[model samples]
Target: MNTNNKRIKKGKVKKKKRIRISRLILVLVVLLVIFAGAGNLYYKSASKAVNDKSTKSVLIEVPNGSSVKKVAKILKEKDLIKNKSVFISNVKGNEKAKHLKAGKYKLAQNMDNNAIIEKLIKGEVYQDGVKLTIPEGMLSTEIVNKLVSQKFGDREKFVKLYRSPKEFSSKFSFLKDSRISTLEGFLFPSTYYIKKGETEKQIFEKMLLEFQKEYDKKVKSLVEKNKLNLYDTVIMASIVEKEAVNDSDRDIVAGIFYNRLDKKMKLQSDAVLQYGLPERKSRVLYSDLKVETPYNLYLHEGLPPTPIASPGIKSLIAAANPKKTDYLYFVTNVDGKNSYSTTFEEHSKNAKKYHQERNDLLKENSSEKNKTGNDENDNKEKSKEKTTN
Candidate 1:
């Protein structure tokens, strides 16, 4: 009886082990069947989406750490792919699933699954709206700098196309045989649309044309009246542009400077000395004034060899139509508001007032720099070095 009982228990144990093994094998076969169906579905759906013809600028954003499944969902939502489940299955089967990068991608409707994967990996046609804004009051060098930084063209190319008379004159008739030394004051300052593959010549012409369009009618006549060259009007306009901060002040400042020019007296403008160099301290030192350059109004009797900066329409008109004033001297307060004087004595008093304000600015700037942990001394040294050079 005991032997029979033992045999029965052994048989029960053997049967239980076989049942467990069968269940595991059954689960594996079921999984294999599911995987095979998924593969077929992926191929079919991916093919259908690839042949679809309704995608218009459909964009998919693949984020960082995204799996193949996540990318498929994005593509489906963007209508770049017909079915997410199949697309994901196909992508998960790919060995190169790790290669899909993070970016905004524009996928064409006619793309195959392979092509869509390649395009996403390549990061094609993202935001597409990169712009370059050339603000008013920039010099030719400054404009070139902006172009080089903004990708309109490079600096050397800009200089060659716009600066070289021989190169520029071939396309622009106005520049042919023109004795203008530099292209400083000629470029019109406004926000411009820059397309890819735009040449340096195209940019120059468009900017120059904009300038011509903004040219005042009276300015053309005034250029004739003064017997002044284009270079002269532009040069004076540049100074007027820098000097006049506001429209009301523009005509008066233009008149004062014009009076000085007509009388052959030194224009005595600190701004001209500061131009073409870096910004200055609150007050220009005697040392700063001693650096010799034609742009220096303190040293040079007349206007600079070229325009100091680009001028606005108001400045241009003011250069043409100067006010009639006996005022020989003008001084601005700390806030750039000014009081004019006819005599040297009255001018001296106003100068003293601004001088005090300038000294205050120096102190305030120093304190601000210290409190903020800024390199005030280094900036001063750099400005000093730049101006001297």
Candidate 2:
């Protein structure tokens, strides 16, 4: 009876052990299947197009300082990526994605993660154009120099295009004025993306078009109501652009210039004198003021024949609507602040103070330079004596 009972118990234990092993195998198989499905899904998502149904090209600007995380967010925002985490993880896993270059890339939504990473790494900037930035108060020569530096074109060719803008003069109404010799003020200082193989003429036309767009109906009405011509307005604006470093002071400087013009007084602006020179100087000397060019406000009255530099919209608006002030004279201080006065005596005093301060700075700089030269000479002499010994 006891043997039979023990055998029954052993049989039950064996059955229970087998059942547990079977259940464990079943669970393992289920887990493997789930993992395989998940792996397959991830692989498909990473390898396939972000949106195979849509084919829209978007301009993606990767600025100077962009991180992978930031780029992933940008891509997500542009609908170029379905999942940010997946894209980021894929990029982090890849070796080539680490060397992404900064540029304006033309990306399409149909591109996959791997394709986009490859494009970024290769820096294959879709060649729509290169960007050129021209700041306000930049002269034609300065613009040409910038173009040359950027390898846009030859300097001589660009200068020729600037000097003789024959085609543009006829095509555009604002340029039809015969006195408009050069496209100095009309270049419209702003950022421009010029297409590859575009001529200097085409680029200038684009800039002029931008200027025309900015000078809308309201601005034109302002010019008409102010009893001012476009050419003169641009000229005054150019002077104002060079004169006023501060935005708030632009209107005041414009007012002062208008007052001088109204009184038939010579607009003795140092900027105008600098414009007359072939090479602009750091400082306008007493002798430089004596230059007898048409652009020289010191030697002649009224506005210059042409705009000295490109004037931004603020300067243009200031010229169109000058502040109502009796102040006729203005001088820039050593700290680059402008002091305005109605009386000549006050103007002279301000000018004297700034000029003396400037002269002192100049003398101090010269003394430092001399000391450096002397130190260099002494070192050389000591070296020579040591060598001789």
Query: Cα lDDT for residue 160, model 1?
Result: 77
Off by over 4 Å in 2: 1-127, 360-389
TM-scores for every predicted model: 0.58, 0.63
Tens digits of lDDT, candidate 2, 57-140: 998988767888888888889888777777887788897776678888888888998888888889887667788999999988
| Residues 197-270, model 1: lDDT tens digits | 77888788777777776774546777677566666777778887777666788889888888877788888676
Per-model C-alpha RMSD: 18.9, 14.9
Total clashing residue pairs per candidate?
Answer: 0, 0
Give per-residue lDDT, candidate 2, residue 50.
75
User: CA lDDT of each candidate?
Assistant: 0.72, 0.81
Choose the strongest candidate by lDDT.
2
Error of 2 at 130 (Å): 1.3
> What would the C-alpha RMSD of candidate 2 be, to one decimal place?
14.9
